[model samples]
Target: MTLLRRLIRLLCGTDPVLRRMLKYWAATCVLYVACIGMLLVQVELGLSNPAAANGLIAFGGCGAFAFYLLIRANARLKLEPDQLAVAQAVFSLVCAFWAYAISGPLRAAMLIMAVVIIVFCMFALRPRQTLVLSAVAIAGMGATMWWLQAHDPVRFPPATEALTFGYLAGALLSTALLSGEMSKLRSRLKRQKRELTEALETIRLLATVDELTSLVNRRHMNEVLKAEERRQAAGADTCIALLDIDFFKQVNDQHGHAVGDSVLRCFAAAARASLREGDVLARWGGEEFLLLLPDAAPGDARAVLERMAERVHAMLVPGLDGRRISFSAGLATRRAGEPFADAISRADKALYQAKESGRARIVLA
Candidate 1:
């Protein structure tokens, strides 16, 4: 299994369209080999003309190998979609010419193969290109019939020649129209899928992120806290710090709500810069935020919050002249298997102690 996966990775890489095309080409090669084998068996059993059967087998085997190599080369080159479509159309025409030459009694059946090729091209080529390729295919089939009739007039009578051409034309037209419609539907579905994916991503961001400060919202923070508590229950250390801006009400009263909002945004940005990668900062409420420090005890968590406090104190709000920002923080480490409510309550109590003791200090519980 590992070897197979490695081989596929080496061949197809990460492009889904390339992988699908590879699978299609692989299937086609397998079908070609099977048909060649059957033709050889018929020649051995004296059920087919030895000379004609040998020639057809040799031609088919070489053609299939050449086609496979061409596809592989194109895959390696990473050709654009338009170029690949043209290459495939040319290959299909060549195969149709071969089929027409050797068809004998099954001449009409070979036209079906040509129709299938044109229909397949609809997915990758525009309708106009598909129509053009269809015309080329019809021309190739007509030329093949003319050559065959010239060589052996008894087989392709002049009377049936008109009927054969008419059938090929009608088949190509109908298949092109139907396949063109299907191609349009496929394109519409692809566009809708892309739009839906983008919309889902936006909704997910709005649900979990605070719009104003770009921090995780309180609701999402609670979910994170619960998850951390579960990790704590498994003997991992985690701590939570509740932060409140000092005299934030005065900033709103004196400066205006817009200025207050700017202050909050600046503070949030500074706090994020000061914290470690594993720490999570979330907007708790108006002028309040929560920081979750995973794999940290109360002492380490307090040190982190103290650094953040110093950073926040140094931030300069534009409309506040030179007044500095300050925040009071309370840190509480979760005990093994302790409930989330109990830990938050302890942090709340410590926060109240810090507010009472001094406005710009951290209290650890």
Candidate 2:
């Protein structure tokens, strides 16, 4: 079973585009098989010359094999899907015309083959392209039938040829019309699918992200903290820090909330740049942020918070003229089997102690 699975993967490959190309390619190859079958039956019934049937069969086999290799190798990366569909339609029509020209009694099968071609093409081509393909098939076959009636009137009678063409014309035109309507329906469904995906993404961002600083929101942070607490209980090192920007209310009260918002944005940007790749920061509340450091020792997590505090102290808030930004942080390394709420409460008390100890410093809990 594993060997069979490996062989299927080798032939079909893992590329989605290549698989789609091969699907249509395989359908066209099936039509080639039908053509060869018709030729063999015609020769057996003595309705076609054996010499002519042999040559046409060879041509059909070569065409199918060559096209299979082209589609399997380069067509997926190079050819537009509609262009490939049109090419396949043209090839199928050419082979059908060749087979019809040689067969005497079983020529009606060629009309069925043409109908199959148009119906298969509906999956890939537009209405206009299908219409064009239908017209070409009807005209080319009609011309071939008329020419054969003139040259071999004993085998292909004028009355029989005319009636067959009338049936062919109606079937192809009606199929073309229905294919166009279905193509339109398919386009509308694709558009609706794209719109639905975009709307879901917007809703997700609104639920989890803060609008002002574009950081993760408080509720989502709580979820992340609880997950980290569980990992800590399982022997993973996790740390939490409560960060509060110092003297932020005065910036809002004196310079207006617009400047305060700008300052918050600047602080978020600086704090983001200071953290390692695995660390997460979220807006805990107005003028307060939360930081999560997973898989870190107590001393290392404290050093990370101290570095973040230094970055806040050295940076300039955009609307503050030449004034610097400062923040106070309280760091707590999670103890085994402790709930995040208890850790947050201890960090909050440490934040108060930092405020009392002249601010702009980090206090370890």
Candidate 3:
């Protein structure tokens, strides 16, 4: 199963349409092999026209080889599903012609194959194309029947021939109409599925991400803290820090809320840049943020927060006219078996201490 998946991925990439077309192609190949096998059985039983049977076998062999080449070149061709369907329809027409020429009594059965081809087209082609292809199949059959009447007038009398053509035409038209309705429904369902998936993704982003800073929001951060607490209880090193921009309200008071927003965005960017790969940064609330550092000791947590503060200071907030953007942070390493809220309360106290001590500093709890 794994190998089959890899093969499909290699041949079709991640395109759902291509994967579906590949399956259709496989089914068609199987159908061709079955037809060839049936022809051989007919020959063995001495119940077939040797010349006609050989012609079909040769045609089927060539068709199979061509289909193999088409599959092999799928990557380079990059054919759309509609294009493949049209090709299959054309192939089916040719097969119908050959079958009609060979199967004297079974000629009507060959017309069913053309109906099947028209049905296949309805899945990938528009309703108009489906109708047009059905017309083409009807025309091909009509022309073949005309030629047969000209060559073997006794075998295909005028009345019987007219009735046969009428029946075949009615069958093809009916199949085309039914298949066309199915095609429209399939397309509608596909469009709805795509829209639904996009809506879900948008909802997910709105729930978990901050609108202004693009950082994970407080809700997601709380979930992460809970998970980290569980891991810490299992003897893992997990440290968290509460970060608050120093005198952020002053920025909004002096420069306007827009500049204050810019500062928050700048601080988020700087902190993100300073943190290592596994660190999780989230907007805790307002001008405050939380940083989760997994597998970090107290010293390591302090170092990471310190570097973040340095980056914010050096990268001065936009519209602040060279005024350094600083923050006060409180670091708390989770103790084994301790609740997350207790750790956060301790960090909050340390944050208060850092703010009371004239701000722009990191205090460890």
Candidate 4:
């Protein structure tokens, strides 16, 4: 048993592709064996020449095995399955032609085997490939029929071979047409699937992003705060801030809503640049932004807001006429087990106080 297992492994490699090839070859070998048996039966019944039939069997059996072994030995080739099928079609056709020529009175039955090859190609080959293969089969069989009529008229009569060619042509051509139609359906479905995926991604972006400032919107920010609140429950320190642009309504009134929008966009860019890694910023509502600093100390959070204010002061939006911008912030640290909304409420009160005292400073809560 051990020796037999080793021999099987030696013949069929352990790769997934190799194992699959073994199964394919097993099915093909069964067909070859059946054909060999058919040839031997014809010879025993005196319907075919024993020597000629035996030679064709020997050639077919050896040729098919050689192709199988070649594919197995180069399992890493990763050959396209259609290309492999095409190779098998060519090999099978050559054997069928030989068997037809020598099978004598039973020559027409070989067309059935050719039909099987055409059906396999219908499933395996693309529309254009199927067309090319059909052309080759038609041409090869036509040439064979012409030769047999000229040299062996007694066995391959002109009228009979003519009828057989017509049957072969109609069968192959119709199957190829159906295969092409199936290919078009598959391609259209694949294209629609790709388009659906892209549409879903666009919808997700619109759901979570503020279209004006390009920051995370209030809804998504609330989700982030909930996540951070859970972290705070486990002894992690997080700070929350609510910052408002100073005199934003006046900017909109004086310079128009366009200039106000530019200022907001500019402030958002500066604030993002000033924040450290692991900081989350969002557009909470008009002119107001929320900031979350995870795993941070109160002092560190203060420094981050101060740095952001400095950057904001340096920014000049379009239509500002060289005037600079600044913002006021209310900062608060989350206590262990405190809810995120409570922390945000405290920050909002501090923000109102900062605006009353001065517009460009941060007030701690």
The clash count for each model shown is 0, 0, 0, 0
Judging by lDDT against the true structure, name the best candidate. Answer: 4
> lDDT for every model?
0.80, 0.86, 0.82, 0.87
**Candidate 2 local lDDT, 10-89, one digit each (tens):** 98788898888888788777767876776788898899989988988887788777777777777445867898789878
Can you write out model 4's per-residue Cα lDDT over 212-261, one digit (the tens) per residue?
99999999998888777765675357899999999999999999999999
Candidate 1, superposed: residue stretches over 4 Å from native: 1-20, 37-49, 75-78, 234-236
lDDT of 3: 0.82
TM-score of each: 0.88, 0.88, 0.85, 0.76
lDDT of 1 by residue, 115-234 (tens): 877876777788778888888888888887788778888987755766888899899988777777887899899999999999999999898999999999989988987877666675
Error of 1 at 134 (Å): 1.0
TM-score: model 2 vs. ground truth: 0.88
Model 4 residue runs over 4 Å out of place are 1-92, 95-126, 148-158
Which residue pairs come into collision in candidate 2? none
Q: Which RMSD values do the candidates have, in order?
A: 3.1, 2.9, 3.8, 5.0
Deviation in Å, model 1, residue 305 alpha carbon: 1.0
